[model samples]
Every structure is written in C-alpha cells, then in structure tokens.
Target chain A: MRLEEKFKKLKQEKKKAFISYVPFGFPEINMTGDICLTLQEAGVDAIELGIPFSDPLADGPIIQKATNWALDKGANVDLFFEEFSKFNKKLKIPIVIMSYYNPILQFGLKNFFKQMKSLDISAIIIVDLPLEESQPYIKEARKWNIDNISFITPTTSRLRVKKIIKYARGFIYYVSVTGITGPRDLSYSQLSKHIKNIKQNTEVPICVGFGIHNSNQVYRINKFSDGVIVGSEIVRFIENNYCEKNFLNKLKTHTKNIISR
Target chain B: MKIPNDKGYYGEFGGKFIPETLSACLEELEIAYAKAKKNKNFVNDVNFYLKEYAGRPTLLYSAKNLSKVLGLNIYLKREDLLHTGAHKINNALGQVFLAKFMGKKRIIAETGAGQHGVAVATVSSLLGFKCDIYMGAEDVKRQSMNVFRMKILGANVIPVVTGAKTLKDACNEAFRDWVTNVRDSYYLLGSVVGPHPYPMMVRDFQAVIGKESRTQILKKEKKLPDYLVACVGGGSNAMGLFHFFFNDTRVKFIGVEAAGFGLNSLNSASLSIGKPGVFQGANSYILQDKYGQIKNAHSIAPGLDYPGVGPEHSFYKKIKRAQYVSVNDKQAVAGFNLLSKTEGIIPALESAHAIGYLKELAKKQKNSLVVVCLSGRGDKDLDIVRNYNGIKL
Candidate 1:
C-alpha cells in the first residue's frame, strides 16, 4: 500500500500509526527480512528501515552502535536490497528506507528509486537532504512516484515549517526535540503545541520521533500527533534480545503491548 | 557577480545539506552574520580583536636562502607567528566576536591538530565565553600537549571515539553537539567546510590571511607572486591564502594534501584519489569506496587526516583555478626539517606539506615568485616528528 493509503486507513479507523525504525542488517544482514516480517506481524502501521552509513551524525549512541554493527557485517546498499527482497513481497505494511543522501547519490538516484519502486517501498527519508538541496531528490522521487519525506524539528520556526510542509510529500517527520535521535525527557505539553501548530498549516499526518524510547512515550506522543516513530528503543530491544530463540514472539508481544497502550 | 550566491553554492559543490534541526539556526546565523557584516560596530570589534588580541599583519618574509637553493623566488606568509601559533586564531577571534554579537554565551568547535582547538580555547578564554572542544580520541593522544593547553585555557576538551577515531569523527561529534545544543550555543567551525554559511563564513573570517599577504607582497615585491601554496586538510589555510588570489589569473595556486603512506596507500589525499560526494554537510571530493561509505583518511599529521576537502576547493579544482598535489609522510617530514634548517623556522607538519610540494613545484616552474602560507608553527607536532625521526633528546 502507498504511505498515503496507510495513513488514510488508520485515520478512518480512528487509530494512530505505530511506526518502528530498525537499522538494516542489525543482528545479521539476512536477518533484516525476518525483522521486517516480524514488525508487520507485530501490528506496526509502517516500518522505517535504516540504510547504515559510515557517518551517522544525526544519530545517538544506540543507532550509531547499530550502524557500526551493520557495516562491520558488510552491509551495503546492494546487499540491503538483495537481502530484503526476500521479505519485501511478504510485507503488507508500507516500508520506507531511511538513508543519508550520499548512498542514494552513489547508488544513482534514478536507479535507487527504480529499485524502491520494484520492491514496492512506499517512501524514502533522506535525513541530511534538507529543503535547500532537495530539488533533485524531489524531482526524481516524483518521477518514480515515490513519496520523499521531509523532516521538521522543534527548532524550526513557524514560517519555515509552513515553507517545508509546502513541499512535504507523504508525511513530515517531526523531530520531537532539538537534538539528535536519542532517549531524553521530552515535555509533551510543549510537543503537543508544536504538533498543533504544524497541524494548522498542513492536514498531512505528522509522525513524531527522536527522544521517544518507551511505550509510555509512544502513547503520550500518539495523543498529539498522527503517528509515533520508535527507533532507538526498538533498536535497543533488538540489540539486547536478538540472541534469544523466542525474540520474534517477544517482539510481537512487546509491539502489540505498546500499540494497545 | 560572486561565488557562493545567496544560497551558498560554489558552482555545484556547496549547499545546506544539514539536518532539519539546524536549518533555522543556520538560516538565522547566515542572516545575523550578514547584518553583522554591515554593522560597523561588529566589524570594528572583530578587527579590534584580530589586531589587538590575535595579532594581524604577520610578516611576509622572503626566504632568500631557501629561494636561492630551490632556484625559486620564495616568500613565507608567517601565520605561524600569530597569537595562537597558527592562522586558526584569525578565524577564532572573528567568529567568537560574531558569537558574542549574536548573544550566544557558549561556543563549540571541532579540532584535529589541536591548533584550531587551542586557538578557539584561547579566544574563548579571552572573550569570556563558555567553550567546549570536540577532538578525536586518537588526536587527543597524538596531540596531548595541545589538548593540555586547551584545558589550561579553561575550555572543556571532549574526546570523540567514533568512526575513524580522528578528525572525521571529531567533525561528526561536533555536528552532533551543535545539533543537540542549537538552542543556546554557537558552533564556531574551524575550517572552510561544513554546511552553507560555514564555508562562506569561515572563508570570510580567514580571508584576513589572504588580505594581509596580498597587501604585504604588493608592498614588498611590487607585484603579485606567480604561485600561492598552502596545505589543504579541510582547506581553510589554503583558502585563507587562495581566496584573495582567486581572480589573479597569473598567480597559480597549489594546495598540498597529505598522503599518509603514499598515493596508493591509506591516505588523506581526497582531492587526488577521491570522487565528488557529500560528507560533513557539504558536497565535496571525499575518499570513499565503491559503496560510498566514507573511507578512513590517514596522515602522519593528524590535522591533515580528513576524508574530505572544502567544497570551494572542489569548485576551484573543477575550474582549474587551483592545483592540488599530495605530499607523503616522509616528504612532509623532510620538508619540516629542511625549512627548520634553511629558514630557521620550524613549520607545522600541516604547513610543511606545502613546503614538501615546493621542490616538486620548482622543478617545473623556474625562477617563479612563490608565496607559501606558513599556516602554523611546529610546536604542536614536535612529539610526532621526534618519534618519526627517532630523536630521543
């Protein structure tokens, strides 16, 4: 399904979206497919699969650790697509590839988007490709009928937010804090206001991420925004429990438990 | 009419390829800096600090002996004699003034060789602002003395033990810090790389080197030098000297990049062996494998150990305005020793790369008037040199 369709269905059901971001090839390169299949089974509305790069400046220690693990295991763009192709057909929910811009540029943007189209991937989030340099990405993504997600942070001014959402494609990634992705004490009162301010400008769904680590945060954040993205928390879960035999079942229960909240 | 138009693109190279969190901050910073540039008080304050606190108009001495020996008209732009013993202080003092003008009480910077770190720490101390420096953990070990000096200047030296464990990682850590604290702090970038405003802003700050050298050379030689040379890491010092001479069609610019072992080995010669790719928030020539994952850059000089060069340097290289050449570890060391003996001035390993390329330059261009930007002193690199040459004393 397209990302818009997923959000529309969730809106019709009066349900908030539960999004999970897992670094590709975390435990093992081949294990990415299983994780995606598991995430979809675990009641995730959408999955944000990370393309690990050498330098992830926007990430905290947790994601950085995962990036290192993935790269050490010889995970590259081609390997990610090749390995994930097995489960791409099995995935029912929309999947977005989260990558820094260089890999996509190096992989050739036209070819990358074509590969994504082939895999039925819904959207792409280039973390570093800001509004200023996004014209090429936007034009190419549009050609591929791919929704290129744009990011807005709490630090973004109201005017800039309006300007960014003007070009926002599928959904706007609302970084809940003024920092990189990590678990931190976030004031929902302030965040809710930020979300409300964004909602006033665009009717597009806003998914909040960064500094959200627990179900409690997912619950609270879901109250204000259309979706909640759990990254470091889920990555931490996988990092700690991937060795266990019943990890997938536990992940389903954990994800189900979080969603029901 | 100029490069890096309002949007900050040096041809197709530079843009604000940063995170959304830093968008407003950088935009505000760019606007604020623009206003500050026009405001006489701000400009005067920066000039005052540059002259009074940091030291400016550093002598441009003609290296008669070295010039005679090499059969080239060689002159040295003595930035090593600046207050912080490197051209870095010029930018540090200027940016801190801008930080102060913008009401930011805290300053953050990333450093590799510790020259920029020490310069920033010293300026931050003099200006009474809270300062934090992010340096690679490996750099902290290699440049322990400069780290100690930074601590003595009351700047918190934070060691980054991330990717490559060197300058590249330090840059990553610093960007992380800046993104995290974009609310109340200012990121005083030490080089002419990074997202939009930084490359242009740093170039403007360090343009003092180019300005002073150009003025001094005209007064002394009554004509422009045929060649302007400086070592390129993130390419600040080279840009510092090269920016002034950019339009001087007759003057050739040579930027020396560090080749760790050799051109074929693990090296920091991104301009030589790398492809155009985005790293550190700007699109530039970066050392990367076929997968586009940034390759680890190595050099005997920690400062030159970077995977990417500045976007402006990329633009210059593309336009054939400046010539970039690589000098290996042995060549740089030899250059360091030669300059020490011939000119009686010990040059920083980073600066020595320029000298290393001089012999190569002289062989091609005969009796050419050359101006080499002696970007820093060798005090910060004594240990590495002593260890390399097996000098126990």
Candidate 2:
C-alpha cells in the first residue's frame, strides 16, 4: 500500500503512527531483516532504512558510528538491494530509505528509482536535499510512484515552509531541534505551536523526529504530531545489545515499551 | 564575470546542499552579506583594513633570473607579502567584519594547512572576538609551528581526529560546532567552497588580487599578461587571481593541483579525476568511490590535501574557461628549491605546484608575459621540507 494510504488507515483506526529507523547492514549484513521483522511485531507502522554514506552530515555520533560500522562491513547500494529484496518479499509494512543525495546521484537516479519501484519501496528521505535542489529527483521519483519526503526544521521560516510543503509527498518530517539527532529535552508548547502553524499550510500528516528517545517523549509528541519517528535511540540500543544472545527480545521489548504509549 | 544564479548554482554546480537546521543560518548570512555590500560604512571598513592593515596593492615583482631561465617574462603577484603570509587574510578579515556587523561575538573556522587558521586567528585577535579553530590532528603534527601561531594569537585550536584525520574531517567538526552554536557564533569559512554566500563572498573579497594585478600589469607591461597561473586547494587563490580576468578571453587561466604521488594515485587533484558530487555543502568535483563514499586524498602540501575543489572551479572546468593540471610531490619540491635558489624567494608547497607548471608553459609559449600568483610564503612548510631532505630539525 502507498505510504499515504497507510497514514489514512492509521487515522481511521485512531492510532498514532510509530516509525522506526535503523542503518542497513548495521550490527551485521543479514541482521537488518530480522530487526525490521521484530520492530513490525512490536507495532511499528513503518520502517526507515538508512543507506550509509561516507559523510553523513545530518547525523550525530550514534548514527555516525553505526553508518561507519556498516560501511566498514562492506555495505554498498548493490549489497543493500540484494539483501532488501529478500526482506521485502516477507514484509507487509512500508519501507523508506533515508540517504544522502550523493549516493542516489552516483547510483544513477533513474536506475535507483526504477529498482525501488520493483522492490516495493514506498518512499525516500534525502536529508541534505533542500526543496530548491530537489526538482529533478522529485520528478523522477514520482514516475515510479515513490514518495519523496520533505524535511522541515524548527528554524524554517513560515514562507519557506509553504514552498516546501507544496512539493512534499508521503509525509512531512518535522525535525524537533536545530541540531543533529540525539537525546534532548523537548518543549511541547513550542512544538505544538509550530505543528499547528504547519498544519494550517498542508494536509499531509506531520511526524516529529530528532532527540526523541522514550515512550514519554513519543506520547508527548503524538499529542500534537500525527506520528513520531525514533532513530538514534533504537540505533543506540542495537549498538549496545547486538552481541547479546537475546538481542531480538531486547529490541522487541524496547520497541513495545515505546509504542505502547 | 558570471555569478551564480538566484538559487546559488553555477551551471549545475554550487548549491546549498546542507541540512535544514543550517538553512536559516545561511539565509541570515546571505541577507547580512547583501546588506553589507550596500552599506557604505561596511565597504569602507573592509577597504580600510585591506589597505592600511593587510597591506593592499602588494608588489608585482619581475622575476628576471627565473624569467631568463624559463625564456618568458614572468611576473609574480606577491600575495605572500600580505599580512599573515597568504591570500586567506582577505576573506578572513571580510567575514570577521561581517560577523561583527551582525553582532556576533564568537567566531569559528576550519583549516587544512593552518595558513587559514593563522589568518583567522590574526583577525579575531585584532578585532577582539572570541575565536576557535578546528584542524585535523595529523595537520597539527605536520603544521606545529602554525598551531603555536594560532594559540599565541589568542585562538583555541581544537584537533579533530575523525575520518581520515585531514581537512575533510576538520570541516565536518566545524559544521557540527556551527549547528550547536548557530545563535551567537559566526562560521568564518576560509575558502570558496561552503554553502551559498560563502563562495560568492570570499571571491568578492579576494578579487582585490586580480583587480590590482590587472592595473599593475597594465602599468608595468603596457598590456594584459598572456597567462595567469595559481594553485588550487579550495581554489580561493586561483579565484582571486582569475575573477577579474574571467571576461578577458585573451588572457589564459591555469590552475595547478597537487598530485601527491601521481594523478593515478590517491591524489588530491579533484579537478583532474574526480566526479561531480555534493560535499561539505556545495556541488563540486569530489574524489569518491562508485558508491558515493568520499575517498582519502593525499598531497605533500597540507593546504591542497582536500578531496574536493571549489564549485566555481568545477563550473570553470566544465565550461572550459580554465585549464587544470597536476604536479606530483617530487616536482613540487623541485619547483620549491628552484624558485628559492633563482629568485631568492621560497614558495609554499601549494604555490610550488603552480610554479612546477611553468616549465611546461615556458616550453609551449616563448616571450609571453605570464603572471603567477605567489599565494603564500614557505615558512610554515620549512619543517616538512627539512624533514624530506633528511634534516634532523
């Protein structure tokens, strides 16, 4: 199903969407599929798979370490697709790839999106691609029925937000802080006001991410946002517990604890 | 002569490909720069420093001995005589002036060769602003003298030990710092390679090089030089020397890149072998793998040991406005010794790359007037040169 359709279905069911992010080939090459399956079982609405690049400017220390580890283990775009094809066959929820733009450009934009269509990938989030430079890639991604997600930050101006939302698809990612993804305190009053301002401009569901760690934070964000994205916290958990025998159980428990709120 | 379009692109190169968190900061800087460009006081303040403090209209010397040897009338645009010993001071003072105008109290910069670091430190000290410089640990070791100079100038020098331990990592660390302190700090970007207004602003400040050269060459030789040559690290020096002459189709421009071992090796000559990719902020020719992983770049000159060039240089290369060539470490060292012995001047390893190309240019064109931008002095590179020659010190 399309990512937009899934959001609509969640709205009808009166449940807030819970999205989880993990770097592809992290911990090990073949473990990502099992981790996604565990996240799905724990009530994640969607999965955002990170395609590791050499320079991930948008990420903090945790995500940077994970990506470096993945790259060191010989993870490449071709290798990611080879493993993801098998994972997609058994997955029911939508999968979105979060990558820097250079990777997609180097992989050939047309070929990358064509393969995404064939693999049933639902959307993509290019962290560094601003609205001004996204026209050509957005045009190609639309041809494959793949949504090109747009990012809005706390520092974004209202007029600029309107321009961004005009081209936004899938959903809007509201970065809760003016810094890289890591644990931090949230200001709900300001966040709520910002979301309300954005809501007046677009009809798409807005999901807040960055600095979100626990169920309390997720519950707080869900009060104003349509969904919550948990990234560095989950990757931090995987980094700490990947060697444990009951890694899946720990991951499942962690996911359930966050989503149950 | 042609500027980037409204969206900050130079023919499919140069855009603000940064994160959304820094977008507003870039917009603020762009607006500030636009306002400053029109403000008479701001213009006067920048020019005052360039003349009285940094020493503008630096001499254009005729290298008679080297000219005779090369069989060409070679002139040196003496950027080395500028305060802080390089052309980096032009951009450093300009950005610091802008930062002060915007009421920013603290300033940050990233450096590869430490020349830019020292330049920024010098300005921040003179202006009484809090300054912090990020440099790779490897560079701190190689450029220990510059590190001391920066500290003595009252700037904090932070050694970055991440991601190949070079200029690339230093820039990444600086970006992280900027995002955290975006409210009170100004990122005094050293070269013409960052997002939006930086490439344009740096070029504007450094264009004094070409402006003076144009007038000086006319006064001395009664005509425009047949060729203009400078070394390309992030291409600031070359851009400074080439910006005014860009519209003069009769004057040829040449930018030399540092090929550590050779062009085929893991060299830093991005304009020669790299593919177009977005890095640090701008779209430029970057050395990266097929999977878009940035590659490690090697060069004997710390300043030119970067994996990417300025976006304007990439644009110039694409349009064939400028020709880029590379010289290996051996050739650069040879050029360094030859210039020191013949002209009684020691050139930086980075500038030596341009000098190394003169032999080839002299062979191709005889009796032509060639202007070479002596970008910096070699004092900072003395230890490296000494060590390479088996000197204990």
Candidate 3:
C-alpha cells in the first residue's frame, strides 16, 4: 500500500497514527523479522525501519546503543534490505527506511533507492538530506513511486518551511524539537506553535517526532498533528521487554488507549 | 593517494555510529580536513604558528644525573616548555586556525584533564572566536585550577554529568553540542581518537613532534634514540612522537597507559586488554564487552583513564612498530616526585606514566638512549597530588 494511504486510514478513525521506529535487527539481526511481525500485528499505522549507521549524531545514548547493537550484528544496507525483503510476504504495514546520507552515498543513492523499491519499502526519510539538496534523489525516487518524506523543525523559518512543503510527498515529518532526537519533556506551547506552523506551510499529513515517549506525549501529540512517531521509546520498550510474547499485546492495548482517547 | 574520508574509523576502531542527523556534519568535516591538509597555505600557516606561538623546537635536554642514577641515557623532549605546558596546544592551534580559515565563528571541545580545555581556550582567545568546553563534573572538581584558567581565558567550561562523569561522558556531551551547532562551530577534538580524519588530522597537526624530534635527535646524538616513550590517554602525544619513527626500524616506540593500581587492578588499558570493537564512532581497540557494550574504564590519573587509544596507535601496534605498557598510579606518583626534584621540571600526572616506564627501562637496559616526551607541566595537578601526598603547599 502507498505510505499516505496508511496515514489516511488512521485519519478515517479520527486517530493520530502511531508510526513505530526501531533500529532494524537491533540487539541482534536474527530478531528483526520477529519485531517487524510483532509491530505489524500490533496494528501500527506505519513502521520506520531504522537502518543503523556508524555515526548517528542525532540520536541519544539509548538509540545510539540500539544502532551500535544493530551495526555490531553486521547491519548494513544489503543485509537490512535482505532482512526487510522477508517482511514483504507477511507484513502489511508500510515500511519506511530511515538513515543518514553517508550510507546512501556509500551505497550510491540511485542503487539505494532502487534496492529500497525492490525490497518493497514504501517511503524513506534521509534525516540530513534537507529539501534544497534532495532534488536528484526525490526525482529518482518519484520515478519508482516511492514516497520521499521531508522534515521541518521549530528553527525552520517560514521561507524554508515552504521549500520543504514544495518538495514533500508521502507525509511530512514535523520534528517537535529544535535539537537532536531524545528523551525530554515537550513544552506544549512550543510544540503547538511548531505544529501550527507546519500545518500552515504544508498540505500533506504531519507527523511529529523526537520527544514523544509515553502515553501522555502520545495523547498530547494528537492535539498538534495528524500522527506521532515514537522511536527511542519503542526501542527501549522492546529492549526492556525482550522475549515476552505479551509485550506486543500490552503495547498494542496501550497505544490503542492513547490514540482512541 | 587520497586518505580515507570516513571520520571515526581506525582499523575498525573509529567510525560515526551517531544519529542519522550528524552524518552530514561529519562528511563536511571530512571534506574540509582533506582540503586543508592538501593546501600549502594552511600547512605553512600552521607551521608558522607552531614556531612562533607555541615555541616549536622545544629543547631535548639530556637528564645526565637522572640517567646515571637509572643507568640509562634519558632525554626529555620538553613539550612542557610550550606555551600551554602540554602538547594539546599543537592540535588546538592547528584546528582553531583551520576553523578560522573555514569561516567557523565558534570553537567547541571536550577536556578530561583540562589541558586540552586550556589549550583550546588559549587558541580561541588568540583567534577571536567564541569557545565552549565540556568537562566531566568529576574532572571540573578535581582540575578546578584549569577550570578557573579556562573561564579566565573567556571560554565557557560546561560541566557534563553523565555515565560516570569523566572524559568519555564529556566527549559525548561535546559531540551532542557539535551536532546541533556545527554550522558555526568546529569541534577541536583533543586527541587522535574519534572517527577518520580526526585521527589522521590530529596526527598530522601534532606530527610536528616527530618532525622536530627527528631534526633535534639527529643533530644532538647524530642518531635516533633506541626508544621513544610517551604517555597514552587517547594516545595523541605518543602518536605525535612515534609517527616519524613508524617507518624507521632503528627506533622503537613505547606507549605507557595508566594502570591505576596496576593492570591487575582497575584501569583503562584498552590497548593492553581490549579487543577490536566500535565506540563513539571509531574503530580501534576499545574497552568493550563480548556484546560490544562499552565498559567503564578506571584510572586514578584522570588524563590517562580513557577507555580507548588513538587509531594510529592501534595501527602501529598491529604492524609491530609500537609497544604499549601499563603503569600503576603508585609508580607514576613516585616517578613524578623523582623527576621534579631530580630535574626541576614538574611534569603533569599524565606525563608521569612515561617517567614510570623510563625508570623500569633504565634498570633493564644499560647505556641505552631514550627520549621521554614531557607532554605537559604539572601545575594543574599540584592540588590533587598534594592531597594525595598529605603535604601542605
């Protein structure tokens, strides 16, 4: 299914989508397929499979540890896509491969997009590839019908926001932070202003990330944007609740309560 | 041939394992470093600063009586004579100068022993750029003198409180700041570890040690010393002295790591006991577990307590051009006292590791010439050692 359609489906229920993110094959690569299946079964609106890169400056220690574990397990583009390809048969959730441009450059962007498309990845968010420098990749990815998502932050001026809006497709990732992603208490006033600014600048669905950790942030996030992305917390959750079959069931019930409210 | 562009990988030791957001910053730094290293103007400008500002060609004084007592010919490279009393000034001057040339308006670095912090503050003071230094809370408390010096020099010393409150935590906090403010800020890493261009770039800047040592040692002895010794924390000073001798089979390089109580006790000897693993985005020997989790590194000397060594040191050790030994805190303190009274030079606690090994080398090898890198002065360490020694000023 198209990436936007998944968000649309969530909007039909008048609920903000829960986009779960995890470093693909973290802790160990062997557990990736299981995690993907678990998230899919848990009714996650979409999934961003974090392709672990060696130098992830935007992540905190928790995510950094997750990436390190994934990298240590020999996680790379080839292996990531190889493992991701296994999910094409069983998982119905739209998978977006999240990574930095260095790995893409190393893998060659054209080839990387091609591989992403071939592996059935519906979207991608290159965190460092701002709209100004994304024309070539966007154009190429467009040809394959893969969604090229863009991001905006509190620091982004309206002029820059318009540029991001112009290039944005699939959905817009509205980062609630003016800083790197991590665990922090969100200032409701600041987050509301950023959300309002993004809504004014873009026509696409907006999903806020970078500080949404628990059910409280998830409920608060619904007032600002169309969806919420919880990355570090979900990784933390999986790490803390490793090997428990009821983990997914509990998370699903918790997420359902947050969104339903 | 072009050097590798990867910022934090050293024979599988250094690479960027940071968030996706900072990859572009690391890439930009990699490009800037490559361009600067190749530029003749940059090279000549850095050379001029080394000569004029830092007082290059610091004397290689022969410790005749001390050598006689130890039964070995020990020579001091005397980096303590440099403007900042440590070799950190070499890298700070090189990088801060590069930042100015690159049009960066701010300088940021992390300090453990505070030598690098003061060195960075010195360069920033001279260059007219805003400077920020992240030091561990523990280090700030211990090295309060250097903390005062940095603040007096107009650099903000931010105390980092995370993960044992030490050098590694300070580095993490600095990197966190760099990712956010990298557009106008240049991260002047104090050592030769971290990702790619850093190890190579720092080694290039401090390579002046090897360059000057080559000319000085040859002029004085008409030959190289049998062994070159320096203390290793992140291994910049040792690498600086050893880089020139890497290809020279005639000279042997020795790196002394702090053993705390001893290697048998808690200490930070990543090179001595660590296996190949990745941390903070570089590949080299690191203190890590079987699952690749970074373990806590211990050492009484805050400067030598780091969990990893520089990439070049790892490379040199792999090729067998360099050897590393661990010296305990008790031995290092004794070495510090011996050097101070015997030679009238107050070596930094970190540099005392080199002296500790020198004492052992003097007993084992008779009439052998050795060049010991006096990497820093001990003025900042006086308070810590005074309390440890139970002596009033």
Residue B27, candidate 1: alpha-carbon lDDT? 90
TM-score of chain A of each: 0.98, 0.98, 0.92
Judged by lDDT against the true structure, how good is candidate 3? 0.80
Candidate lDDT values, in order: 0.91, 0.92, 0.80
Rank the candidate models, highest lDDT first.
2, 1, 3
Better of 1 and 3 by TM-score: 1
Best-fitting candidate, scored by TM-score: 1
User: Could you give the DockQ of candidate 1?
Assistant: 0.88
Q: Of models 2 and 3, which has the larger lDDT? A: 2
DockQ, in order, for the candidates?
A: 0.88, 0.73, 0.13
Worst 10 residues of 2 chain B by lDDT: B1-10
Clashing pairs in 2: none
Poorly placed runs, candidate 1 (over 4 Å)? none
**Number of clashing residue pairs in every model?**
0, 0, 26
- Across B126-182, the per-residue lDDT of candidate 1 in tens digits comes to 989999999999999999999999999999999998887899998898899999899
Candidate 1 residue-wise lDDT, A1-261, digit = tens: 888999999999999998999999898998888888888988999999999989998999999999999999999999988988888878889999999988889999999999999999969999998888899888999999999998989888888888899889888899988888878999999999989989988988999999887778888888889998889988988899999989998888777777774
